[model samples]
Target: MALTPDEIDGLRELILAVYGPVTEELLRDLCRCITAAGQISSGDEYKLLLAKSLAGADDVIADTLRRQTDLTDDAVEQLMRWAAEKTAPLEENESLRNIAEAYVKVTRKEVANVLGQLAAADVDGRVYPIKDVYRRTMDYVFREVSSGTKTPEEAVRRATLRLWQRGIRTVDRSDGRTFSVEFMAQRAIMAKMGEMTTAINEKHHDDGGCDGWEISAHSASAPDHEPYQGRQYSDKEYKRLNSRLQRRIGTLSCKHIAWPIKLGVDSPQWTNEQLAEMARENAKGVTYEGRHYTQYEATQQQKALENSIRQCKDRIAAAQEEGKLGSGELRSSRILLRQLNAEYKRFSAAAGLRTAPERLRAAGLGRALRPDGTLEMPRPAGTLTGSGGKLDVEEARKSYSAYLDTLTDAPEKNMVWLRYFTEKNPTEYMEDGTLDAPFAYDPVEDRILYNPRHPQFSTTDFEMANTHELAHRTDVLNAQGYKNKAFVDAISDASKAVLDNAEGFQRVAQAVRSDLMKDILSALSSGRLDTGFGHKAEYWAKNSEAVPLEIFAELFTMETRNDSDLFFVKKLFPGLWKEYQKLF
Candidate 1:
């Protein structure tokens, strides 16, 4: 495991006290990796070559140092010996330390000379492709930081700061004490670092299937602190913030150069054909009457269009207020607004963001009432959170009733009754949600749910069950929307690939359920342990399980801390529990 900053600092001090002085090379390697992703180039390359030779290579580190560069075999051998002698056993003998430091002093001078020569060659040579290859290699290097620490989340953020040479994303900007120096170095490297963008956007180099780059670090972290290795190459809409470093306009946005650079194209004047070709290449293949619009160009046009829409709205509002516009102009203005929103929606998928339709729907500022006494989208009690509505039972029951009424118009509109119950202790509730029964949906009964016992009747339990039931309804509708079992099978392979998708949901299903369960538990027992699991069972009915309501009650009875609560539910509810247990 990687040591914490405090732990590492302590180790460093102790090593210095015992050994007199420590090897600067190991510390330097760590600092170099943290300086800029580019700084770690040689070390990373060395590690890769070492890995390739893992099966058998006589002194792989030495071999790598010798073959990958012009360094003599003897010099490489000497450095390797010094590194090995100094890297570990810090709590052991001290006499060898003097010899190792002597070797390091010599190696440093040689290293400085070699790096100087490489820098000179880069300044005067064709290093574009070579730099691109190096950046891609660094991308892989950062992707593996997960292997170094249990807190992969922290590791990812740390690596991002170092990789970009920008501020560490972990400390929330202002919360740094010991980490501030590292964060500053990280931020400095990322600021205006254009070469890295050129490397990632190399996808747009030939085929132009790019819009533009937007860079954000990703996290590959498991809850128990394991490495989360997955996708590394970012999607297209990500912006390259250091655009000044990468000075080309997008394909569509290149309508007229906002600013032009003659750095790459050689001649001061650009041909019409050349400009058009460049723009098309950047347009990334979305043809407009067979002429492709470059991604850079499209972004510029989209921004201009939005500005035009905003102007139209201002003009119309002013005209109406001043009594200069007729009813016709007002109606036309509304239509224009709709069209602008639609355009945003169209580009949203490519932009990798929520479509316009989603934004409008979520605002919930508009509504329609059903004949059945339910509001279609009642102003949701200010976005559902872990803790639910007004804690008064009467008001909560009313809110729950309103929520049920709203769902009544939900297409299946068939009366969907789901109840949930969970254990009084939330940790236990959480443990069960994650482990024991991670929601097994039985589509046959049209019931979806989760229930943990509640010690007392409270808003938290009610909120938990309500969210779970609603989610189950969504799951059912989604399954029904599938074209055929075979198509769903294919989608499952691509999405919820691991589960083989017992039903038509992706990896997101388990996640959604978990959050919903948390909300349910959060809504109950604000500052105390609940008594039992009746409400949890009711929630299981609609959110976690597809089993009959009774079987769920039986399952809760079979596996829970409050067995007496099951008896209480059975005594009160009766027949349904016995019938449900038979399904097994």
Candidate 2:
């Protein structure tokens, strides 16, 4: 089994607990030393005072190293139990249990030895002995205070920030590489789990005399491994393939697993076309703040943001503990934390990714505070309001929120208000009766007017209408209104693609089909062409210029809901689908 977010968080917390507190205390002591050494005339005099202040610092460092080793051993024990539970049935066998235990024992020692090193570097690329890092930090603090460049409190806060940002680095001098203690621990744990699982699976395959295996499939798989997933391969063929791949299956950080299968009995789990579509969807990732990010890239961004938030919280706590609650550092850090939290929500909503609360937590940190001293919490992405209607207002809001959750690229928060009306119409009908449509987008007022009393107000119908109207609002905000040249060109290309595959279009479910010809004919005969049609294109020929806008909205709804019409669009109108994806 893969490591869950909770499990990862727990491991990180344990690793940080081992070193984080020790580093914090060290900084605190150094700050105290700097504060006590007031107005030293020369560097030598300041060094003497600092050395006296941190008299037993060496002993403290030694004690911390010992504690870290002990904690690492304990963490490894927990990790082993987790791994054993994941490979359950196999653990019942004594031989396998013994094998796993022996491997864990050896890995545990290596992890402990590596973590015992206290070599770390600061933000300015200054490397220092873990024991001597505090001295250098205090020296910098003293210089700033004595030179009148910063107050004693400000210098202390800066030192705290630097320590939290870098954490305690475990350096590998051989390759000149450094890793935070938490990162190193995570890597060791994942590697151990992967190796154990692979060993157990191989033993099973051997005992069963299996000649073939199937690899598991997951979203956002690495491109090199995408083709091999959800497919059955003979043992020999798989071996040959694995040898040539850059990242082989069952490797560290590779989530794929090879399960034993009978050569002629088991079939592939997914069809080639489905796999191809999955790849296409992964490639066409969501857009946030004008930057495109694949699913994997988005998750990575979330991790970075989560780390920064934790650092901010830590800085605030350290400042408060030092009785510098009103310090500029504390105030700025609080403001930045709030901004990070809000940005996290907006980015997650836009990318259609769920936020992991566990990842945002840090030990000994309370809720962030606002300028008024009240606790601050993140707000929802948008709001829904209903007026003058028998509509289940709460239900409507819930339904709208649910649709937003399903969107890969959601509209900007509060970009358009949602107003529902059940007993009355908000806008007069157009000459061709398009304005009286069930859902209408009012660009001037920046709201979507929904008439739930319309005949097509079933659950599914409501969802479709919601999506269709939201698409129009999104288009207007993003594409400079629906009649822009770029949108019109895209619609023209998609229309051509649809025209080329008229037979396929006819096969689409009637409810989902956009019958442009019927609308064009009605507009020609109705004599309503003189007066321009409103928001929607009920009569295409009447407002020929709006054909692209109407088609774009319909296609957007289909794509968002994954309606069957979209399958036909992708199959028969590849050009159209490709163009449609770019508009978002």
Candidate 3:
């Protein structure tokens, strides 16, 4: 289990507290010395005073580091216990408990060694001795105050804010990257816990003599892991699967858990249908602020907001301790904190996600909220104009007739079919008066019906719809029925090509203006094209038999719209578009 937000906030507060009072006092004393001396100097008296001000900072930092290490150990132990209990049913002996104790012992030693080396924190990847940080901070404050760049109070406030914002950098990587002490600690603890849990589960499987393990499933699983979720695999198969993945199962940051199970004896946790439904639900994510966000994306957004709010609180606390409560920086930070909190709540509610208030908690700070003490609920995005409005049957007929009149240059055979169908089937309202099934063609009755008030019609112009229907009519007439082998083969070939060259197809999808095209392309890019086609393809392609026909009609409409769209269709499916061109 990941450390809850409250735990993380606690660690953050510890790190901030390390520098808050000490840094502020150092700045104040340095400014006073500079004021008396009229300028900062390297003389022995100045050096002596500076050394005296920073004398106990190292002890304070070391003590805080020890406390942070202890807290981290506690959090890791708790997480281990949680994992052990979760897998307790499968445990045959005290081995899991032994594993937990050993892991915690080893982890505590390792973390302590790492934190011990950090006698001074690094800022922006630059390690500084405690004396150097004080010297640099003092120099900066002196320069700003003496140069008229800032008043003494402003300079001290800025310096203190910077130190608090940077936090204590405890981990430096070979890649020349550095992370705050708490961040690295949390990451290491969680990673070790994951590894320990994986080892324990493997031991259980070995002890139970299970043939394989079943990977757990969850909504919005990482893209690469989604395919393997809820499925059981033999030992060899599981190893081979991991060999192909950049991120193996049960690795750090992966929430999936595996348990031992006899292949034939233990029932699968999820059926195929259930897994498929989970994938579909994940694909159909909620829209917030006019942009679609998958469940994973939504959670990430929430985390980001939480981080921002925490930072704001830390800054505000630092300012208050510095006695700059009325400073502009503090005022802006408080205002931003409120906005961030409101947004976090609204976004979670809109996305149908639960808000983790513990994650929003900031150590040593009260709740930050608007004056009304209530967060505003999010409203649904505005509805499209004319959506589900009344349909003027005669006007729709006239519109289609006028559209057909412009296609006189079309092939005689196609024209005859279109004109005949237009006369035989006058446009009429759907029985429900809404376009629940807008712009449909019934080949059995040789009928064409439309719902002009459909929301989709708000963006899709009439010419595109008419051309699409005409294309469908021509396909039926030429093939003598909807079961056209050549048509299906062409669409199948194009679809395969699209899948094979998904990146290129996405580029083409980007160039197209049609929302339908964008949706189809997005699905293709995400390996969900078939899923999209089955569920919410085009309005015309609702069933298996109709997919190819609807795709062809869609491409036909795209080609007829403008030269740009025609080029896109050609780029998307060169062979299919070429073959379709002969129809014109």
TM-score of each: 0.21, 0.54, 0.52
Q: In TM-score terms, which candidate is top?
A: 2
| Pairs of residues at least 3 apart in sequence or in different chains that clash in candidate 2 | none
The model with the greater lDDT, 1 or 2, is: 2
State, as a TM-score between 0 and 1, how close model 1 is to the true structure: 0.21
Query: For model 1, what is the alpha-carbon lDDT of residue 224?
Result: 18
| Model 3, position 209: C-alpha lDDT score | 92
Residues 245-330, candidate 3: write the lDDT tens digits. Answer: 88777654566767778988999979999999988888888899899987767767876876676566555544444443225665
* Per-residue accuracy of model 2 over 1-584 as CA lDDT, tens digit each: 33433444444444444455445444444444544543464788887877776676666667656755665677577666565556546446776787578767977876775666665544255666665766676677778878988876666656555565766667654575777665666666666766776787677778778898787776666678888887889999989887898877765566676777788887877788888877877788788878998876787787688678656655654454444422566567666876887898888788766565333232111122211111222111111223433344544543344233223232333223222221122222111123355557776675665554544332224544555665666667564435556656655665554455555543342333333222321222232222232233344555664565556666655444444335555664466557666665
From the highest TM-score down, the ranking of the candidates is: 2, 3, 1
User: Please, what are the lDDT tens digits per residue for candidate 1 over residues 190-252?
Assistant: 221122223223422333443222211111111111111111113331233224323232211
Candidate 1 vs 3: which has more TM-score: 3
